[model samples]
Target: MQRMIEFPTAFWVSQYTIRFAFQEEISAENSRNVRLFRTFLQQALSADLLEVVASYATVTAYVKRKVALQPLREQWYAQQASIEVSVSHTPIQIPLCYDEEFALDMQRVMDYTGLAYEQIKQLHLAKVYRVYVIGFLPGFPYLGELAEALFVPRLAKPRQRVAASSVGIGGAQTGIYPLDSPGGWNIIGKTPLKLFQMQRAQPFLLDVGDCIQFYEITKAEFRQMEVNSY
Candidate 1:
């Protein structure tokens, strides 16, 4: 059985704004519930009625002033108990190059995790990662709960600046830097893919709840692909 808690009376911060919060106690055993809750919100509410955001364990919905809070809350409760979302299983494949030059923190990762280069590569490529959320940077998708064996902590001190297209892992999360910016995550590798291409109609490649996988590519292949524009 699923559970949901709701707030009523429309807690008003400003005259035009009201707040309602729900905490869905999702199972940690699997991330399926997280994905289901995301899809449910996308389906149940009209495009203008509410704005929904999902994290590893929680889903928060923000409704506009014109929308009725009570009905929205009730509908959310009903949807939580219903099993209806058919989430797509098609995983997006990303090509990565882990050459020492690209992997700025390769030795650090080896020292921290006590794993050889091949072991690290195997663990990273072995599992299918889930797109938990897209925040922190535009088009930057927070992926995983990487296999326990590959987990590593964030950098003790963050770099003043990190290059765009750099891939890194911190704690249970692994992500690619969508643009050049200050970052603290341990750099593992880099990808040439334009994750957030402003020229594209959609702009963002990965959306919330999408699945992702990474495959290793050679330096030569990376250069050729960079020129060829796959």
Candidate 2:
């Protein structure tokens, strides 16, 4: 059965701001609950609501200055009790090149995981990753709860700068560096895909609660795609 929590009593602190918090224990086996929670929160959006943010396991909804806290809070509680969200099964596929030229720390990854290059590729490509959050950098997505066997620690010392498009793994999480910046995560591969393009109407390519899948591509293909401006 699905689990849920609710905040029925609203605590008013000021004319504009009120506080309400709920902690619901959800199934962590997959990203379904995360996605459902995000969808449910989005349904709450209206003129009175200002923002809605979802993290790994929690969603926060903010309201506008004119909205009355107590009535809105009560409505929110009722909505939460009745709302049902369908989890999405479709995954967004991303193409990446893991050749030595593009892979910054391939050897280190192989050594640490005690797995062959092919094995590393298999593990990475096999699973569908859920975007837990988008932070640290604009459009930088923190993805996974990688298969336990593939979990690896962050680098002992962070690099002064890592290249943009760098794909890295740290702990149970994996991410792509949207921009060249200082970071401690272990680099595994690089994607030619432009994760964050400022020129695009939507600057961020990925958002919280979305699913991502990475596919291995060749260096030549990567170059060709880049040339074509894909």
* Backbone clash numbers for all candidates listed: 0, 0
Residues 121-158 of candidate 1: C-alpha lDDT, one tens digit per residue: 88988878888778998978888868787678888899
Q: Predict model 2's lDDT versus the native.
A: 0.73
Measured with C-alpha atoms, the lDDT of residue 225 in candidate 2 is: 75
TM-scores of the models, in the order given: 0.80, 0.81
Q: What is the per-residue lDDT of model 2 for residues 1-230, given as tens digits with 9 covering 90 to 100?
A: 64554432345545544444334432343244445544554565466566666666555556665555456546554665455445545689899888888778878888888999898888989988888878898888988868777788898999999998899999888999999899989888888877888898887778787788999889899898777654
RMSD of each: 3.8, 3.6
- Which pairs clash in model 2? none
Give Cα-based local distance difference scores for all models.
0.74, 0.73
Tell me the spans in candidate 2 whose CA falls farther than 4 Å from its real position. Answer: 1-31, 66-87
Runs in model 1 lying further than 4 Å from the true structure: 1-31, 73-86
Worst 10 residues of 1 by lDDT: 21-30
